[model samples]
Target: MNCPLQGERKGSVNRIMRELNGISVVVPFLNEEDGIRKFCNTIDKYAEKFDFFLELIFVDDGSTDSSVEILKQCAFQNIKQVKLVKFSKNFGSHAAIRAGLQYASYEISTWLGSDLQEPLELLELSYEKIREGYNAVYIEKKSIKVSKANRIFSRIYSWMMRKYAVESYSSGGISTIVFDAKVRKYLNENMEANSSIMLQAMDAGFKSTVLSMDFHERSAGVSKWTLSKKMKLFIDSFVAFSFAPIRLVSIVGVFIFCIGVVIGISTIVNKLINPNVPVGYSTLASITALGFGITNISLGIIAEYLWRTYDAARKRPVFIVSDVVTIKECESDTQ
Candidate 1:
């Protein structure tokens, strides 16, 4: 079907106020129709507490439900500023996030999902810390009320993240974060709206500070991030940010080669000494191990960048403007 924004282009829309600076909260939402009021209220509360000129930019990311209308409902509050950019289709969170960052007319840019597991109170701390002297202030989850299995996996994930991605610091700790507009511009201009948009923020090459916090139960509709999606995010983060996984392939190859040499030497010694040691199992095992080793090496090297390149090559437009609610589009780009 043709997008709503395209239809709306011929109709009335939200009006933009005079642009303000300080902090812009970019919330990327899909089917968050039920939580818009609560989410906006929390943002209003935190904005007052922090005493910053705040604007809430909700990117609808092509929601196929009443979320756009719900966002429109909150637009009446106009607490400082409330803006929504409804995409023509589901360009996904990363695209919505990039749009918010680009549309953000502020000094610092931040994003929080509509799920509400991340609290508004932490934004106060993040804003304060960003002002103090850091390029970015990442909110690290100190505790989360997930299942025991999730907690264990989170630990292992964080450990692997620390070792490979950040090089020296720990990750998976950061759930929310705030960064200077300059750092955000780097990704907004260059990144594909594929996955793990946060990884781009982390890779911005700045002295980032971490603030430990806790994740609470959601305050609204169910999460869009399934276990499978989260697993893909974990893999994407590693593949997008570091090459340690591929390096492991090389390490495994060397270890197997060394082991094979030793086994061959031992087999010859045994044959010379008694010539009766069984060779069937050893030969079969060696062949299996060698095959596995080569397969892993090939997979790692081939995958190191193939998927990302494929996504880039597809060159999907980040967001389709079904219509404009606030900002006017240039004739060339829109036409």
Candidate 2:
């Protein structure tokens, strides 16, 4: 069923507009019919309070529902411009966001989630930081009130990202961000498959500011972030940004080789001491199984890197835009 825009504004606007700048917000969603209307309403509400010219770039990530239709029919009072980019098929949120950035018109561009987990006010905060001379602003979630599984995944992913991939990565992980045109241009040119866009942007070495915030739980449609996708993201992030996995494999190989040599010498000495001792097939079998298991895991890690290399060499387009719908409301404010 198609959801209509909320009759009353759902966003809270406590502070008045401090600056006037054209802001482009890229929203990537998949099957978010339940929340897209409210999401749009939130943007409109924010526009009412804050007079900054707003340009919403909503990227439809191949939703099987009426998310796009709802967006097309939705009306806004204060939003300056709206662009809906429809993808050929489901290409994942990261790719969808990249496409949206490519189409972004404003000098300052940022992305928001359809679930509304991040507050709309972060835009103002980020804009302030940008005006203060930062190239980008990362809204780092200090704590996320999600399920146990989600919490665990977030902790592990953030830890690995900080320890291995990007050392400057936030401890709680980053979901919301605002960046200027330089970073936006960089992202538009660097198209990476099966990679984290946020990681790429951060790894590019931009002058950035971090604003700590707490994440709200989902109050609408179910999340499309499946376990398989998360696992793939984990692998992609490491392979694309870090050499730790390859280094770990090499270290494990050396350690295993040394262990094997020590075990072989011990077995030879034991055999010389007791020539009639019964052969310990159980120990031999366990050792063989462990060795094979480790070797297979190492091979799998190497295969991931190889596959990404091949994928990059293929030079496939990161995303395909099947259609685009642009709507302009009155005259947009100049930056």
Candidate 3:
């Protein structure tokens, strides 16, 4: 199908051929019906200026709303190539992005959210940098206009990732990223169910750089990411990428064992000093409870790791595509 915006300007064909290159923009969204149309329009506008052929891949993470329908409608309206991958159920934004990447046809693939908070102009800079030999270009948030509590939480999360998961974790937010085929291949091959894509990309040992940008407010729809989801992402990122949790359990176990020995020696010394002294039930109970709590926590952490190992071994597909609507099919139907 020919680009719909191609004939809008005089001598546009030559410009497209000379300045524009093909790029696949992978967008993962869940229940983003309010903003999907605006998001697509913004992408179209960017495509016009950059003169690049856009292969827009929208992965619908089982939106119960009209998101998939809106995507289909937009696909029919746009001249740029559009592909919709509808999930059977809500997998996750990361899973959706991974699914999109598998079907991407272009060498340069860019990831964007459906909320339209991130500026599309970053693509131009990212494209330029990638052309200059960078394997990946990441759009980093210089600052976000969020609640103070959220800001604090974000800082703590960032610190945890840097201290435990990966040192470059600060550069790994899922805002906007443009990567070449090499980076995409690396990610596809080393897929982890619970890991953050940005961290995975950072660990891929690619020549990458971050472009700092101001994060804008969402144009429409409330963020589907709840506190629980944020916490899950944090834990998943750490577990999938770092062995620090296991190390922490080991350290705590050793500390508890040493404390137990010290307490035993102290109790023996006290009993010898005062054989008639009554045993303090409260002290015995407190020590027993503490030991039990620590032991249970340690077991829980180990079980978490073991469960993830079993999940990986099962090799379940990260996402199941229930339906796909492509631009070519839409064009054919219209013709």
Candidate 4:
């Protein structure tokens, strides 16, 4: 309900900021004005279920709408435990979530969408798995409101991933998941800010499990992610997880080299068969042009691979955070 804000003073929740400890609920959003309330309500439900002080760290990822205002209102009213962190620009979902993770107060932090599509109940399931000794548990999308084309592309992309990029090959039938802070820290510690953590989690060699969950339609507003975005994510998934693209280029170069050797042997046999057959311009010109073109293509691929390595080495900023709200230390004392 439109709670007033006092110029964003570290989230003014009038509710008793309880002394209970453990668990941080991080929800990152971009233009989720209508869904924030319901999302907060879901957080309230989970808060009650857990009996631990729930620190709902909500990131407003450069929303032009009333989303930040809505979060400010919720924080002011203090229905439950929520802290608003507003970013200066839209850095996308992964960046927003990573920002939230950096400021997370509790040792056990989990993230989900602001739409509540990744069910709050998954947190409990994830926690249970963590208790059982898994480092990370990622949400496996069982079913989604995706189109047929998207599904096909996803299948093809995932297949390519298995064949070429990343590691820890596991797919299909997994959704909202949970794990310890160790896993989260591992990801934030050694990942590209713009890269997806899901792939890194797979490659980290951590014992992980994926729990299935019902994918619900967005409760409000439009999905920020589109097909193009998904395709980009698909590429990111491959680059993030596997070096197959680079490896594929390397393998192709080797194959081409072998083929060139065989062609050289064939030319010897051709000369032996007919010494006057190809001491001419036509064959020489064609072979020279073809060989030059293939060599250039192979060199170009190698250059691309080198550029990718340069990108990794630069350590450029993937995300810039404008604000953060985490668990207060008074709460940390209890933990």
TM-score of each: 0.80, 0.91, 0.88, 0.74
lDDT of each: 0.70, 0.84, 0.78, 0.65
Q: Flag the better candidate by lDDT, 3 or 4.
A: 3
Q: Can you give the lDDT of residue 236 in candidate 3?
A: 89
What's the lDDT of the predicted structure labeled candidate 4?
A: 0.65
> Per-residue lDDT for 1-335 in model 1, tens only?
11122334433322122122357778889888888678877766556545555667778876777877766665322245466777878776777888888767567888888877886777678777877888888777887777777777778877877788865345556676688866876777786645566667776678788887778888888778678766776877777778877787778778777877887798788888987766768686777878686887768666757877787789977677566464222111210
Best by TM-score: 2
lDDT of 2 by residue, 186-216 (tens): 9888889989999999999999989998777
Rank candidates by TM-score, best first: 2, 3, 1, 4
Global fold similarity of model 2 (TM-score): 0.91
Evaluation by lDDT, superior candidate among 2 and 4: 2
lDDT over C-alpha atoms for residue 193 of model 1: 47
Stretches > 4 Å off in candidate 4: 1-21, 75-80, 166-169, 173-177, 256-304, 325-335
Query: Which stretches in model 3 have alpha-carbon errors above 4 Å?
Result: 1-20, 75-79, 171-174, 328-335
lDDT of 3: 0.78
Cα lDDT tens digits, model 3, 1-335, are: 34444434644532342343667788899988899888887777666666556677888898888987776676334334677888999998889889999877667887888887787778878888999999998788787776777777777887888888878665334466799889988888987797788888987779988898887788888888789888888888878889998999999999989998998898999999999988888988998999999989989889988998999899998889998877442122121
Q: Which candidate is the best by lDDT?
A: 2
Compared with the true structure, model 3 gives a TM-score of 0.88
